[model samples]
Target: MDIDNIAAKAAAKIDAVRDARVNAVKTAAASSVELQEAVQLLAAAEQKYAKDYQAALRADWTESDLRGFGLDAPSKKAGGRPKGARTRQSKPANDAASEKELIGTTSENW
Candidate 1:
């Protein structure tokens, strides 16, 4: 019962949970606008949850040099953490405002 093994088990459990939710949503869906919205919401929630789970997995890493989510662990020498990992650290930001605005400052020269 080491950290990596426990993590793998927990991830398997999480995947099961996600799959159940998706299946349930699919079963409940109808050819209606409301049903469509519900399905979209479920998909968005799953996507967000998956991303958070991956981040957590990375944060508490205790496995081999190779890294990633689920059962796949690729490396460069062997394909791990991917080359653009550092660049992926922050969101694209994609803002046109000045840095001050980004930090919630006013152009009032405060």
Candidate 2:
């Protein structure tokens, strides 16, 4: 065969390989996006189901029933300071004058 024919055949083969690679990559990227969306949807559904299940349990059972299952009753607040936080009482006006007399004037002296 002529050099021109051989060169044309090789070029065609290279183009075919490149087109196949591009298609494969596009397919994989599309599939990855679809899979990610599905995963997120599944996670949301699982969370909703868990919350609904807890509400159902609360409606059907008493606090003692949960304790029997080795679960503590859900706290009024999830995770924060208790209702009545203990605060230090401020010094009284009379005590403030006496404090300065007992303790030195400056913090360094105290």
The per-model lDDT (C-alpha) reads 0.62, 0.76
Q: Candidate 1: which stretches are off by over 4 Å?
A: 1-31, 61-110
Model 1 C-alpha lDDT per residue in residues 3-88, reported as the tens digit of each score: 99999999999999999999888766644667788889977766665555456557876444223334333221222357655643
Top model number, lDDT: 2
List model 2 lDDT by residue over 1-110, tens digit each. Answer: 69999999999999999999999999999999999999999777666655554675769976578678775644332333566889999999899998987676566675
Model 2 misplacement above 4 A: 61-110
TM-score of each: 0.29, 0.54
